[model samples]
Target: MAADLEQPVAGALPVKRTFLLIGTIVIAEPLAATILFPFIYMMISDFGTVQERYVGFWAGLITSAFFVPQMLMATLLGMISDRLGRKPVLIIGLLGSALCVFLFGLSRSLSWAILSRALCGLFNANAGVSRTAIGELAHNRGLNQGRAFSLFGFCNSIGYVIGPLIGGYLAKPAQKFSWIQSGNLFDQYPYLLPCVVSSLYSIIVSVIAILLLDETNQGISYPTLTGSTVSEETPSEALAEQDPLLTRLKVAAARIGPRNSTWYCIIGVGCVSLHAIIFDEIYPIFAASAGDHGLQFTSKDIATSLSVMGPIIFVAQLVLYPFLNDRFSSLGLWRTSAAVLAVVYPLFSLLPHISENHQGSSRIVQWVILLVLLAIRFTANVVAYTSISVLLNQVVAPEKRGTIMGLGQTAISLGRAFGPALGGTIWSWSLGNGLPPPFDFHLLYVIELLLALAQVISSLGLAKSQSVYL
Candidate 1:
């Protein structure tokens, strides 16, 4: 971590290996984040402590536990990364996440599970630092900033694809898979198999990062976008000359330094994160809930669909996202995707209706519709997140990149902290209380659509330029 080198110009950059390393970082966090989603409610159920009617409430809180500490500590870690360098922070976050998530899997009760998740969130600042590292790495390579960030987004899509497979298939190995069920730790902990697998992968990746990853901080930050070199004085001076609104944002992020485009990107990510989390928390609960209330799916059934969907999302990102940055403004592309999501959420809400109205049709038909709608919705959201991440790195100088990106993660994490809890309670209330049509599980999607529209509107306030930093 302490190894240092003079900042390299474009031709001297380590393109392939650096991408591989950061790509692992990008995928590992989400892998850990989502691997538990398929079975978390079931884990809580196994505790047998929460009543059936309120399981939704507890499940949401358990999921939210990971993000709450992440929200609180992201910026602090980012600052730490800036001072100490990205490699050490990355190692700490990766190893810490592995330990914490492994602890959660070994937990005997809900309280222990929640504590494990919270500690995991507190220590895993990998998302922010990884972005920080990618931004600097790509910048040093004189690459299209969008291309580097797009690759990370693509890896994220891969994570979504793989995480659920591990969660769905590997969890409860004692019950789901035979062979050594009698002797394995999974027989005792039940959920430990997947966590153990994910933790081992994380530990392996951390060791690779420790050995191969280089420190990006040179104690100086370069300010340029789209490979256009410029003077360091260009950014703050450009903001000071803009209208009063820009000045206000500058003041808001002044403590962190160089807030203009970065702040806009963070606001955009926050809106998307809020909508994304509601989907994350609400979907599985709605799917796994019993009776005629929802899909009434088993954990394996949910995993089956996700394993299918994750690959589709990955291919779509690979095929479609590469063309985006070249053709559209970052904010424009993001807002357009957000608008598409606004439209798709309603389609997502139509699934239960299809089930009720067409009882004689193949159940496969409903699953197809659900998969299509989810693919569209998640793909759009992923594009928005990736594009916004690129915009964040572009708008901020390299020196402050880690801190600002951490702040961005903090903002998104803050939205997510409320998301699981609020979405869980709402879904629980809808299920338990039989709220009217819109207020039912259907209402969660509706609110998300509305938030997407608002995100579109808020994005209009951002600079519409292709590249803003220089």
Candidate 2:
């Protein structure tokens, strides 16, 4: 472990092709996930399965369904990738998620939508696998891990931008555009267009991954009890064959790393992810709501607001992050971002109040304020996620990278699983109960602020405990 900590940073040749392939694969999950954001409210309404007041609840449930199974499966999948290799696991996840996306698009009922999303989450283990692959590929080549991960972040930023555009414009195509008659596949299934596009993107990426992506876990070795190095193939395979379940569980539990630092890092990332997801699930709903509390925006308006995040994130991740990563510790950067998020989260609740204060044409001022706040939040989130990823990857050994990354994903998935459901439930209750100020709609952002502060505290703990690594 000490030797692992002292490993020198390598300045080897770039693995552009491999990074490119991984980035392409990495973008697919976010693309598929965010595609539902813009139209989810309307889609739930179309089902007529719940009352208008409870649409938020059902929408939140469908969103949460995707993460519930993902949380359960992430660590297992990560462990599997460590044994079987990253490429196969990634391709399988991509293809499985693609099929689920199609099913989600075709869903006419809440049950089908929830089931499709759950299955999608169950199959989509690419999040951890791809991160593991990037870490391994960079470590193997002594390449700049920061740059590689930044590219990963860059791809995610693009997906976040493009996914909303696709969902906002392509959804309900028969109603939005007119060249065809009313009795078509798109007309019959209004949300199918974006899903088809998202699914096809995944299928194409999966095919590309099969053809081009190389396995990073191949040649990696681990230490045995007798101090001999065992090849990747023999140890895990032998252990699994010897004791299928218990040994693997024991090994996984053992490799989770120092509880103080490793778990802090995991918890820190999880907290940030929880608030970010809650914001993602609630923002559009808040904006589209018809009452004085909302922005009264359409799906297109929501999409446009979200689309602006792409370029902001692109600039932040590609340009600002590299500079900051070069100057400060990843832990330091993460801590700063968390502090900023603590300030930003509560500000979102103020948007409606800001708009309410201003009347008529001056309302444009509120839009400006909204975009500025979003830009800051998105920037902070990009910094936090990218920095924590680098920190998590650095904290573990190369051989256990997959498991650690998977554990990290598990933390994130757990937060996402509950963020939407909790956010939606609270939002509905706040509105329906006629709660007073601070207890009303503001309640959600207050919770988000608390999480951000917790993230800040955890980052401080991580810094103190892992000072040498930082």
Candidate 3:
């Protein structure tokens, strides 16, 4: 399979089409996941399940709920895709996410809402499956894998942009728009519209996948000399079953690839994911909180700020990333981006202070500063995410791509799951304790900076040991 993948393809046109299909399908999960961010604080508050002071904690829990099950299931799902083929797992994940989104919007209580989000996470193995498919497709077709993954990141930025818009604007339609009067579905279920829209988008993408997407697992396509099809596991399973315990361990280790490089890449991905998710989960809660500690922004304001990230990330991933990748290579770009994030994250803590001190005409200046900082943060995010993903694909063996990608996704899911719960807990503790400057709201940012710095250290290690692959 590895030798076959090295051969050149006839043209780029078909490869482009496959990338498009995979990219489009990959958008649904992120869209469904992020659509709740704009309105989630309000949603938790409306549930009346906890004191206003503790809202951040519950909000964080809800945010983390979507990732917890994903962390547990991603590796298994990836391994399943290795056996069952990628298309089926991808479609099932999409459909499950769509159903869960609708259920989440209809949830009237906090427990139900968390359950809905958790189920959504359970259904989403799309991230790993899509990455594996794209990696395989790019390698077999002789396409630039870096460019293909960057395009995947571009589609994700689009979803991030659109999801918040839907959540921000459509969340309380009855209150926002005069036509959406009281006593109707929109009024009764205030957050339902955004979920419906997000769910429908996923369904549309699933339909497209069913019609146009082809199976990229080459093992499934080839026939053996005896006219039976070869499976990804046939050789490995046979060896593991027949060998002694020591040899079985060797087989397992080989399946995981070069341990030092592979584990370093996974850790790098996890750290970046942790800091990114903490920012996403905390930003809105911080913006909505009252007094001097927060920006005290409404859902629309938070949404507007987040919406700006889409264009910045879109341009960064599609235009700037490819150029940077060419000049710096994936590891270099990853290191630089991680260093930028370390610098950029701490700046966010200054925004509330800036808004507090600045007033009237200076309000415009505050908004500008806020947007600029967000732009920088998101751009670094796109570069780091795309580069790390490309490196992950490069480090794994061809037959083990599915399982390895799944493990990578598992690392990301674990970071995402832990980040929100930790951020929310810290935010709530800071507010409740009435602590000093650095220990107060600034604490989360400090932790974020540390995570980014850790990523930089990991990148340095990879640079010394793994640059040969680049």
| Candidate whose TM-score is highest | 3
**Ranking of all predicted structures according to lDDT, beginning with the best and ending with the worst:** 3, 2, 1
Off by over 4 Å in 2: 1-14, 220-259, 357-360
Clash numbers, per candidate? 0, 0, 0
The CA root-mean-square deviation of candidate 2, after full C-alpha superposition on the true structure, stands at: 7.0
Candidate 3 residue runs with Cα over 4 Å from true position? 1-13, 222-257, 357-359
The clash tally of candidate 3 reads: 0
- Could you tell me every candidate's TM-score relative to the true structure? 0.87, 0.88, 0.90
What does candidate 1's lDDT look like per residue over 1-470, in tens digits?
A: 01122334442335667778888987887787778888888888889888887888898898789899999988988899888888888888889989998998898888898899899888765688888888876655445666677778888777766777788788788776767458677788888888888899889999998888766654433334333343344543443453343444345445444444556678888988888888877777777875555676788888887777776677656667766666877777888998999999766666765675434564678888888887887788778988888767756755677889899999888888888898888777776566677777677778888989878976876654323322
- Quick one: best lDDT, which candidate? 3
lDDT of 3 by residue, 192-270 (tens): 9999998998899899989988788767643221322223445334333433532433454455446677888999999
All candidates: CA RMSD (Å): 6.0, 7.0, 6.0
| Candidate 1 vs. true structure, TM-score | 0.87
Candidate 2 global lDDT:
0.81
How well is each residue in 294-353 modelled by candidate 2, as lDDT tens digits?
A: 888888988888888888988998889988887987888999998998898888887776
Quote the lDDT for 67 in model 2: 92
Lowest summed lDDT across 10 adjacent residues in model 3 is found at 222-231
Q: For model 2, what is the alpha-carbon lDDT of residue 17?
A: 64
